[model samples]
Target: MPASTPVAHSKTAALARVLDAIPKGYCRYTQGNVSASKAESLARKFHLRYGIGCTPAQRVTRRKRGMANALLVMYWPEGCQQVEWLMLATDGQGMDGEKLLDIADKPGMAWLGYELVRRPDRGRTAWTWRRPASEMAEHYALIAEFGNKHHTNSLGSLLQRLANQPGFHGVREQSKRLFEEARRRGHAGDLPHLFYVQKVSHGEWLRLG
Candidate 1:
């Protein structure tokens, strides 16, 4: 399916589709807007990958119960790529956006390419978080190490440290520009969240909350 296409006919269906699409064993279903039977019915009618009925609330709870080495998906209609959306989703789900951002910011996951995508079918207008799993195998060791280092798992804190590292100034500048643009576009919040940052051989790239 096209990345932008809505996977289901309704918001509940859309959420269920996402829950099913997540790699098996990583999540379990809980009731939300859609009942268990309804979720299963929609999944079957839509031929979704997983026929689990779950809500964003349930998904958040399940995520917290497991390890912190997973991607977070946020849905918003305003089309903001700023940290505000991350924070809002985290607050709604009862998970920590900073921690999830830390996992996504790892050097090994850089290839996953953090970006916001618009999903029109789900709600006429909505954006979903995306990190393609194209190179997960190559970064398994680094990701595992990251999982082991729970003490250093805050994206904001990590970014502060990276700011002191050589050659990270440009990255910080770019992030500032993005934040400013988001603010100008009315997407700014009281505090910002760090989303993803990558340091390649040539330069660094960053996405802020």
Candidate 2:
């Protein structure tokens, strides 16, 4: 969970460029290898909090999904950085401990490491994982119902106007009402709750889950 660690050598220009290309608040880069045990321990720090109507197994499954996606960016001596390992589990990424150790054993290979990190921003605009298929279907059904109810104002026209307006105050108010309606209809689940009303296209403002 450490965002950074001190290393004696300065970052090479290539490494700096790689770091710049990576989006902020996603991962942190360091100049050394981390033990598997250490990486797992770091991954353990992320826990899924239980919520109303959520089961313990669901929480565990989601946590495992997140940990499996935690990638380690490795820079080999060949001057290339690639996702060489998963922080917690290796099965999905086609990597294992022995393979990593063998690569480290090679001589004259420079290595840089990067691991996923938690973001401090709590903004609603942040990207999120998609919801379950059943839940998404409910949202789409609701959208269709709303379109039928408000035939005078086409959904595409409303979305286009929202796109033109800064912050889209009018559409945002509509989104808030729809979210409340979804919750009332038991469409929104308790865990992994939907927060943002994202704009997927000029003609659509939807929670893309």
Among these predictions, the greatest TM-score belongs to: 2
TM-score of each: 0.17, 0.19
Over 1-209, each residue of candidate 1 has an lDDT whose tens digit, in order, gives 11112222222233333333333333322222334334324334322222122344544565576522222222222332221111111112433322433222324212113332334544564333333344223233333444355423433343344333222223344445434433343332342544332322211111111
| Total clashing pairs for each candidate | 2, 0
- Model 1, TM vs. native: 0.17
Model 2 C-alpha lDDT per residue in residues 39-72, reported as the tens digit of each score: 3233233221111112346435645665222223
Error of 1 at 37 (Å): 60
Q: Rate the local accuracy (lDDT) of all candidates.
A: 0.31, 0.31
lDDT, residue 149, model 1: 52
The collision pairs in model 2 are: none
What's the lDDT for candidate 2?
0.31
